[model samples]
Target: MPSQQDDADPVDTSVAHPARRYDYLLGGKDNFEADRESARLIAERMPTIRLVAQENRWFLHRVVRFLAERGIRQFLDIGTGIPTSPNTHQIAQDVDPTARIVYVDNDPLVLAHARALLTGDPLGDTAYLQADLREPRKILDDPQLRQVLDFSEPVGLLLIAVLHFIRDDDDPKQIVDTLVSALPEGSFVAATHVTLEYMSPEQFAAVRARAEHQSAVRSGAELTALFEHPRLQVVEPGAQSVSRWWPDEAPQPRPSIEDVACNGILARVGPRSA
Candidate 1:
């Protein structure tokens, strides 16, 4: 892994960043009062938002494990927040000790603490890149990503809980298409996006008011559009609530779509037409 100190970016603690706020919501301590306060404000509007984060994480774990089970040994996780247990590398390495992972994020704080995310099994390798998802070409061309991942082989691309941060003006679909296009056949894209489909009008309004600056909340159809590129084919279960996507086991009390408030999908890159 490259050293973050060589190109150390300044971190602004005065503002509430989405990654830090998400860390706070996940009960992690690598966040500031600004993040905690922002999380508190959002919680006031959506009481179950914390659970939503947890379920979103659960979805991530399941997808990583599923990919490993399908013989995928390389991973590129974008929008990776603060270091959390059972991270993409951890989960993938658990299945195969030789799995390699590349973690990408724009948060300077996440880069500052990236050393923690590098401690993977001896057989596997882990690396971090301080980059934004909007610049898919740069991320695809990054030296570290090329060093750790072989574009000729199938790689699991994780976009969990990050797409919402990309507004429509950025052309999120094209961004996704660009990333997927760079990967070889059989590579998979697993993503989860915040949705307003399950929320009532009043609840949606409250959430939008709190998160408008943070991200754009889309409906289910809009969220699905991000994965509808010609080169991609939807996997089983298609796009559905994060909690409902291939759960390890059905919850004793099953969570409704409203409880998760997010949609997730795992799709594969298809062969190009002759």
Candidate 2:
């Protein structure tokens, strides 16, 4: 995993950034004209992108709550975007006031906003790390992460809606494997990824071309394969649309597959086979 000099990187507001564009799509005010323009171009092709972003956020909420209820407390959430309401730490700490979270993101703006807004519960703990997800070893070895979490215990490794930004050439699978390898048995890896499987050929091509960040949208099988490391086993409900995965309360009118284009899974690491 290549490491960019986090300190040397400057915030370029002139160019649309993935985190800022996502914040804008989610109706947050931390975006600039460049981000809005980028979002506008993408929304022009798939108008429901905002809805898709919301669905992915909801998935994060549900998954965090589920993991907390299951007694998994420590969280290493990489690619954490701008701090939004009911953020990952908020949801996890709500379930268990002592839950610990380490929020990691490469964007300096995200780091700035997160450090200011992502306060932890008095009973719990939270820390922010400005780093790239590609360097799993660096993240795992960070002193801040070590300070907040106990690697010996079960942890919830969150990769929600972030992996799509990593191109296939980046070896995203190796990144995942490296992160998972550092986690102890009983730890859970939950991830949500954007997919092109549901889109028409023309729509898929158009969205990819307009996307500000290079994306590697995968098929269901390919996405599922990301969690197929020997030490990890995918949990029930497998990989499916976020809205369709264990809904808390059904909407009056259920959302169709077209309503959400992301697939997610919660996989657990267990004892190595004899």
Best by TM-score: 1
Candidate 1 TM-score to native: 0.95
Worst 10 residues of 1 by lDDT: 2-11
lDDT for each residue of candidate 1 in 147-228, tens digit (9 for 90 to 100):
9899889999999899999988999999998998898889999999888789888998888887787788887678778788
Q: What TM-score, over all chains together, does every model reach?
A: 0.95, 0.93
Spell out the clash pairs found in candidate 1. Answer: none
Please give, for residues 1-274, the per-residue lDDT of candidate 2 as tens digits: 1122365668999998889999999999999999999889878888789988888888898889889999998999999899999899899989999999999998988877886898889899988888899888989998878988999999999999899888888899999989988889999999999876677888877877755356788766787888889999898789988878877533435466676778888999987567
Cα deviation of 96 in candidate 2 (Å)?
A: 1.0
Q: Name model 2 segments beyond 4 Å from true.
A: 1-9, 211-213, 249-252
**What are the clash counts of all predictions, listed in order?**
0, 0
Off by over 4 Å in 1: 3-6, 248-252
